[model samples]
Target: MENTNTLTEYLTERQKFVNDEITNLIKQMDAPLQLKDSMLYSMEAGGKRLRPILMMASCESYGGNYKSVMTIAVALEMIHTYSLIHDDLPAMDDDNFRRGKPTNHRKFDEATAILAGDGLLTHSFTVISEDNQLTSDQKVFLIQELANASGPTGMVAGQILDIEGEKVETSLEDLEEIHLLKTGQLIKFAIVSGAYIGGASTHQLESINDFAYYLGLIFQVQDDILDVSGDQELMGKPVGSDENNFKSTYPKLLGLEGAIEQKEKYVQKAKEALKSAGIKNSLLEELTDYLSNRDY
Candidate 1:
């Protein structure tokens, strides 16, 4: 009960901080009214703010001030939001709803939605590059990291693989590879970027990378579980869309019970990585469990 309360309070405070930072940053942008409005639309559409909060948590765990990493956190969220906007396009998943609200394309026109995504993606780099707190070297490192995570060899490649895999049966290893690129890359950026900003030692960074990798797999596995068994109202989107789209998933490869077991395995792996890293961050450990067990 005490652990639950502490986790709840920690997530609440950090989520509020991320949401406020994102809102303020978007508001300060000098852009067209319609574009700004479109951009803010998805930004305000509610979700867990997982990436930013994870970034901040990782930073705090490494003895760095959360405020120092705020810009990067916000940038990570912007990139994530942009991806969602694009993912909902007619040429993509073609979803009409997000976070219980009209998707960006549904709320606005397709062209506007595309531009909104473009604006957010470009502006994220500006936020990172222009931050005064980070040195130029750090800014370059972050830019490279984000590019590698989201560019052709990373999330985009994973997305292409997913689209292609929908046509045929994909091996479990292949599916894992696809998700590692599509989902895991950005997640890795969130954790590693924080450690980088916090000036972690080489050994600490390696352990943190291991933790992030396993945690990413756990995150995707839980998502697969939710898509099969989650409440639509709480999920803010239709469940079983993976089945509808004929996408390969962990639950499809492994049975539902098997998928749950797989998630637990990765959760344990993540915890072990943290232990090996000698990082005594209870919140980070709790977050891994919370993510695995989340209903939405």
Candidate 2:
């Protein structure tokens, strides 16, 4: 990886690149002005941009140019944004705010928000298909992987489980399963797919896959932790919304101390997986630590 820049600097530079690319891609889409506006609204609404950054970082960790996976990275971000848009709909989480702004459904009409999410999700595949950097086989593999992660079997299944779990008490095991699918699957795709495109060996892929799973759990645990004890202004949304929704969370299931302990366990496991993959002292490791302790 590039050793000259700190992680903060690297993130800022890469985020700008990803944002510019997303804008360019949206401009090329021959869609209605309203639809495009809704899509851009959520896309430009700021978050960590963690998924695309992880994909790019993973590729570079294996000695591949970040540009080699840039299109796929953007596609992953689009899918993530789509999920957030739909998740905030009235029929779903009924969230009014996201990233400190009115959600898509609130900014526009519910129907238009739904279409914007649909446009982004479907158009992501088109973006990948048009990438000149990847071979036909690579494109096919990535598309299948992304579909399996975000489609009915992966994130969708987890969403249903989360909804159901809200009505009843949930076990630790059950909660892990829900998050592993809901949050972890896409995270797994971001890292593993990037590494594969960067020319990882089969053995390395196996180890990194393990790392991704633990990292995903860490992310959800921290999210749950933040819901219990985070600043609304910093997070750009109200905390304790989980309790309001009666959703089961790490802090709820395991207590605050237990949740912190759980995050640490996952952090250690993630580092172990990285060491086993022969990937050490890299951006992936740094990002893992950051996720464990993030306040928002």
Candidate 3:
């Protein structure tokens, strides 16, 4: 495994690359100035860029050129950004800030924010369809994967479950199901789609899917922990939003200590999945540790 410094550098470089690519793609799109501005506002909001990074990493792991998958990675980020925009709407989380800046709705008008999200979502499909590097079959597969992950069966369903889950005392199992669909589905797509683009075998895709599943749970568990203990400055938002919003969380279902224990278990499971797949990816291994141990 690489040392901490090496891993940090690697992540930083890849994050910069993703950010630059996102900016370039947005500029290339021909849309109304205000709409493009709103989309750019949210897209430029600082984030860890984890999803796209994972996609590129998975592609490289399977000996596929990362550049070949760059369009897909960018589209994933656009979709994710659109979700965040809609998630912060008044009908949703009603968050005022994201990434330490005004949310899309807060930065612009609510209607503009909603439209910006719609624009980004539709533009993502155009991106995939227009990418010259991918064959028609590859494009179709990517579009299908993105649609499945973000549509009714995936993130949208998860969002509905989250909204409904907040109204009642939700069980641990139910909470897991909500997150698995809501948060885990797109994450699963990131890993699996990358592997697909890289031409991974069915067996390899299954293993990576398992690894992503555990990682998604760990990601949310850590978010729960951070909500209770994280610094607002580094977190880029107020802490305890979950409790304030009366949302169900692992730390709420299990005690804080128990939540930490659960995160650790998922971390181990993620690593074991990679091992079982006979894959050797230092970045992915370190990512598990880094995400679980993150302060923000």
Candidate 4:
């Protein structure tokens, strides 16, 4: 019971921290007239803020301060939200719903949505690049990390693979390859970027990277399961989406029980990585467990 109480408090506190930063970043944007409303529409929609939270969690886990990484973390979420907005556009996923409400294109016009997504994408780099404390070397790394994770060789490649996989029968290996890039890259960036910006030691970065790598894959596995089992009211999107779209998933590749087993294995791997670091981050450990078991 005490353990449960501790985990609950950690989650609530972390949520508060990221939630505040997200609001501030959106409010302070110097957006153009044509794109402002649509950009704000999705930015303020209140998704999980998982990436930014992971940045803080991982930074703190490595004995680094979370506050120092807040702006960069917010920048990560903005880039992620921008991708989702564009992915929902007619030319992409054509998703009409997000967070149980109208997507950007649904709330605003298509051109506006396009420009808004574009604005967010461009501005994400600007925010990180313009930060005064980040040395040119650090800023360069941040830009590279953000671009590679969200760009052609990373998430975009994964997305393209997903789109291509639709045209033909897919193998389990194919699905893993797609998601490793598609979802995992950005997540990996979130976990490690915090350490990079915090000036973590080389060994610390390696350990943190290992923890995040498995955490990221397991995170996606849980999502595939949630999209199958989660309530639309709770998930803010329809359930059984992977099945609905005929998209192959971990649950499909390895049965539901098998996928759970895989997720646990990765979670264990993540925990073990932290163990070698000889750190006591009860919050970070519990967060890994939460990601392993989360329903949405």
Candidate 5:
């Protein structure tokens, strides 16, 4: 049966569950107090918790028990949080604030922040490997796939390209490549891993994977759009930072209208791919619309 809950209500309930799990995970860690604090600072700093939610939604779409993938979902969120911690460091984006709070580097020492990111990144794999719910093969598949998605050929590669592209003009194709890897890989992992664990047929997995790819692009495109037009208070950050940084964005490459059109195209393709996977009237379909239309 389709989820009857509105997206708002669904996100609230799922976010609370994810947050509780994250807090418990941190409490169980044997890390130093400072390190744990630093890690938790960013972890608790509110955002949409989109990655974990996506994994949960994908699994549910395939009739799998959401609890079965809960550990993986939390691990995925840890990875995302770690990336944000580093991305805010002076050596990187040098962002001082995130989610309206001082960034990890600002709240804690840079060294501690770096170590916190490292701790989160490395420990994510540990949680997955140690999870009692998954099979050995499932663990192997997830660990390898996560490494591939977040490592050199995936998000990191995309990040470096984004940094390099900032110094020079970037074509629309180049921009797409940058975002697809930097932002899309983990998103792909969230959906693919969840669907795989949820017992999707191979053919269905292929279609769902395609849907995830487009959704990732849609996410980035909307991010670019929000950078230009979103409310600063709601976003918990200043608008126009992208412009100030002179970074290549969808809006910069293609006027605001063009970027919106591009986002619409991605949304349409995402829906088609979801339908192809034989998933209909599910939370995934609602999320496709919600993500693109989100203000923050």
Candidate 6:
């Protein structure tokens, strides 16, 4: 209960901070009214705020100011939201429910949704580019980092392989490789990008990246489990969507018991990486456990 409250308080402040700053940025934009509203609508939808929280937490763990990390944290969330908007398209996951509401394509027209996703994607870079607090060197490095993490060599490539996997038989190793790229890459970026922006030592960056790899994989594994067994209100979508879509998953390869075991492997690895970092935050440690054990 104590752990939960601490995590909740930290996250609540971060979410509100990210939301306000991003809202101010959107309001200042000179886009068409409808397009701007559509983008705002998608942004307003509630989410776990996981990526931003991770970014902030990563920075704090490195002795960097969480307030200073907020903009990058918001940028990561925007990038994440953009990916989600596109991924839920009719051609992709076709998801109607996200965070207990209609997916972007359902809330707005498909064209609007696509444009909003594009807007968020490009606007995220604008935030990065226009950030005045970061040194020019830091800004350039972050730009390169964001492009790689969310670009073809990263998240997009993973999505391509995921789509391909759906249409054919995917070996277990191949599926892991695909997910490591698709989902894991951004997660890794979510953590280590903060490290880079914070100027963490190489050893520290390596530890954070190692932690992110397991964190990312464990997150996806938990998603697979939730899609199988979670309630509609909690999950905000139909269960068993993976089976319906024929997406390759840990459960598909390893069966229920085996899959649980596999998730623990990644979870343990994530915790081990955190321990090696020698940080002393109970909340960060418990967050790893929560990620692995959570139902929604």
How many steric clashes between backbone atoms does each model show?
0, 0, 0, 0, 0, 0
- Regions of candidate 1 where Cα sits further than 4 Å from its true position: 1-5
Model 3 pairs in collision: none
Per-model TM-score, in order, reads 0.97, 0.98, 0.96, 0.92, 0.98, 0.94
Off by over 4 Å in 3: 1-5
Model 2 error, position 113 (Å): 0.7
User: Residue-wise lDDT of candidate 6 within 121-231, one digit each (tens)?
Assistant: 999988887888888888787778888988999999999999999998887789878988888887888788766665578888888888988888888888888877778
* Model 4, total clashes: 0
Judged by whole-model lDDT over C-alpha atoms, candidate 1 comes out at 0.89
In model 3, state the lDDT of residue 246. Answer: 69
lDDT tens readout by residue for model 4, 168-228 = 7788778878888888888889978977766677887788778877887888899988876
lDDT of 1 at 10: 77
Error of 2 at 127 (Å): 0.8
TM-score of candidate 2 relative to the true fold: 0.98
lDDT of each: 0.89, 0.91, 0.88, 0.81, 0.92, 0.82
lDDT of 6: 0.82
Q: Give the Cα error of residue 263 in candidate 4, in Å.
A: 1.4
| Residue ranges of candidate 5 with Cα displaced over 4 Å | 1-4
**Number of clashes in model 3?**
0
Give all candidate RMSDs, comma-separated: 1.7, 1.1, 1.6, 2.4, 1.1, 2.0
Q: Model 2 clash pairs? A: none
Task: Tell me how many residue pairs clash in candidate 1.
Answer: 0
**lDDT per residue, candidate 3, 1-296, as tens digits?**
33336767878888898999999999987888999999999998988998998897787777777778888999999999999999999998888999899999999999999999999999999999999998999889899989999999999999999999999999989989998888888888888988898778889989999999998898888888999989999999989888886699999999899999988889989999988654645667777788789888
lDDT over C-alpha atoms for residue 229 of model 4: 71
Local error of candidate 1 at residue 225 (angstroms): 0.3
Candidate 1 lDDT over 62-137, as tens digits, reads 8787789999988988888999999999999999999899999999999999999999999999999999998999
Task: Return the top candidate by lDDT.
Answer: 5
Candidate 3 overall lDDT versus native: 0.88
In candidate 6, what residue range of length 10 has the lowest lDDT sum? 1-10
